[model samples]
Target chain A: MIVAEHKPLKELLALVEGFDRILMVGCKGCVSVCNAGGQKEVAILAAALRIARKRAGRPIAIEELTLDRQCEPEFIEWLEEPVKKGGCQAVVSLACSIGPQYIAEAYPTLPVLPGLNTTFMGGTVTHGVWAEYCSSCGNCGIANFGGLCPVTRCAKQLLNGPCGGSVDGFCEISPETPCVWELIYERLKNLGQLDRLEAILAPKDWSTSLSGGPRKIVREDLIL
Target chain B: MSMKTNLKGILEGSGFAVLAAAPAVCGTDLSAVSDFARLLKGKVTAVFAADNPGARVSASALAVSVKLLAEGVEPVLCMTTRDRNRLALESDLLGAGALGIANVQIVNGAHPSLGSHPSAHRVYDVDAVQWIAAATRIASEKTLISGEAVSGDPSFFIGAAANPFVKTPELHLPVLKKKVAAGARFLVTAPVFDAARLATWLDNLKKSGVTCPVIATVAVLPDAATARHLARAGRGMAIPDSVIARIEKAGDKSLDEAIAVAVENIQAVKALPGIRGVAIIAPGSETAIPRVMEAI
Candidate 1:
């Protein structure tokens, strides 16, 4: 999932300072699961903004709306009616970076502010811990390393690893972090696929990654 | 047609394999690098291609290596694990092999954030040791990590970097062991400013059972700023107070002082055991090479 964290209150307050009324948009997407920009989080932010404005003697009005997903225009179109009726001047998007960008493009006349800093594509590791596990390089080679993605797992992103910096199965960067290559080596050893370690991985074809440009996929059959 | 034939006299006569260290190839003027290679010609055994020296991304080291090879100089490509992923690194190795480049120095590259592209995403997919191991596999198996076969005799002399002035040289011994175990044939120390400390570190390395031929680095520090810059550049590399004082006292004659220091360092390193050669690293002061070589 795309992970993100809320921007500081000071910055958000500064963003909507001149606006008399504003819309706070949330997403039921990755931001919701990460507890960053979900419905609950949007409400909390709206309440905080109200209290902050009241203290500042401004007492601005706010209209909170949670969208299914802010990235798609179909969900974004839901805001047109509410924004027109509510007399809101600006919008605050609590979703990942895509949400605010989509809202900005959808309603170019109004100012759209981002409420969260879009972080890496990651998953919840434990209860509150989230670890990044993929680089989204477009080319996937997890099967070669016993399903451990070196592009995301190894600090150096080396196709071959262990770096001699691993001690007691922990990475050299931090003792708390387990060396991913060590894990892969152990897994390969257990699977009796250690010979797979002998092959050299080639340099990636970067045309598939951001090296080329913004990437897009189109299915000819699905298109009208 | 043979490149090594021209290098035989210099390699045999000096009793030391001198490697001319090129500056970082990022945004490099290749013609200048080629000219420098031509200038040194038969004076050096090989030219070492450096990665982003100031942490700025530029042309790939493999690119520079090929250019040097074209100039009729044997090239040792420097591979930094900080930017390119495993796939890119292996491709570069194959490319180097195809170009008849035979030497590679593997080092954990400077973090991308440290360079001009501070916001750039870094890919430290593998550290230097793993890179060495991977390159070794490519040289021997002639295949890639994805179990794909590549056509090339990617045979290479692997090299790794060492820091003599590290906080504790003893602590870095394990890293050296890992580097050698990962298939590094030789080691290059960070530029030596303090000969006694380097001698002590060499003794410790020997005691730790590391028998790889070490190439001592000697840098020409033309000024106090250059001294400080090198010290900061190497990350924990020490510049002795006495050496700094000498450069400071030399005032306008700092270049001469740097030359004297480099010459003195070469002499001291030559007296030490286990050192196969001395690599002279002078960025803007290539003229000092001749003086240092004359002393040799």
Candidate 2:
């Protein structure tokens, strides 16, 4: 899932400062699951913005709405009616950067602002904790290392790692982060596949990753 | 014969090899290299041009290595996987070979976040072991990892870093063996503050069948404050409380005590069976290196 967090309130306040009225949009996708840009968060942010504006002698009107997901065109169409009603001069999207980008593409006249910063593609590790698990490098070879991805987990992203900096199974970057190579080594050892590590993995082909360019997917058979 | 063979000969020879580290060789001045070479001329074996010590950005170690070689000193260019991809690594190796810099120390560098640039993206395209393998293939096989022919002789006397201070040295054995298998001719342990710990690490290395020549590092602390700082930093570097206490208790003689401690460790390191040399790392006190070497 794409994890995101709210931009600072000051920054959000500045984004909608010039507008007399604005529509705040939220997404119920990964952001909602991470408790960042959910319906409840949208309402809370709207209230906070209104209060901060009112106290500053510049009370602004804001209409809050939450969509199923902001990345898709179908969910984005939901903002059409409210935007057409015409008092809304700007839009504050509480989804990942994709939502604001999508809104800007759909309604070219209005200024679409990002209310949250898209951090990483990650999953919930605990009740309210999330950690990055994938880099979306487009090349998946985690199976060889017993389902662990060094490209995403290791700080240096070395194919062969647990560099000399690995101390007590923890990464040199932080004590909280486990050395992924150590995890892979231990996992492969337990599975009796330690031989997998004996062969030096070749240098990664990063053309499949963001290094190539902005990526896209097209299925010829599914195209209408 | 290649410079790599000459270096290997020095390492395998009965005379103890003395490597002096010249950290952060990024400035416009080559005087530091000349001054260091002049100071250790007859006494030292090679000058190690470190790659971004403390993760701070510095000039390429190969460039510094070239400078050291020009100054009549053999150079050990420290190349880290932290900054370059395999192509760049190979290109640099080819360039180093062209310049006649023979010795190369491959290690996974310190994370950029630990350095001056915390926001910089890291490119650890290859790990240390894989890099050692790639370097060996480039040198001996005369082919790049992509199997393209390397034009010139890029032979390297390859060395890899080993952290002797890890609490459990046994867990580090497999990787050590893998490093040796990957063509690391020698192993350089992280700075040793405790000789007993180094002895234990050497014992473990011998038992694990890693009989390669080992160069142990000894950091010369100038005072109790630096000792405390190193102890607190703890990046797989072990500075036992007893060692720190000795420096602190020395009062006005803290600097002498620090040098004495380094001298003592160098002697103990030299006595170890698998040990080939001692690399003196005196971060800000390069002058103290001669004293340590003289005492050892």
Q: Which residue pairs collide in model 2, if any?
A: none
- Show where candidate 2 strays beyond 4 Å: B4-6, B168-170
Q: Under CAPRI classification, how is model 1 graded?
A: incorrect
- The TM-score of predicted model 2 comes to 0.95
Q: TM-score, chain A, per candidate?
A: 0.93, 0.97
What fraction of native interface contacts is shared by candidate 1?
0.11
Task: Give the range of the ten consecutive residues with the poorest summed lDDT in model 1 chain A.
Answer: A160-169
Most lDDT-accurate candidate = 2
TM-score of each model's B chain? 0.90, 0.94
lDDT of 1 by residue, B232-266 (tens): 44344567878888988999999889889989989
lDDT of 1 at A133: 85
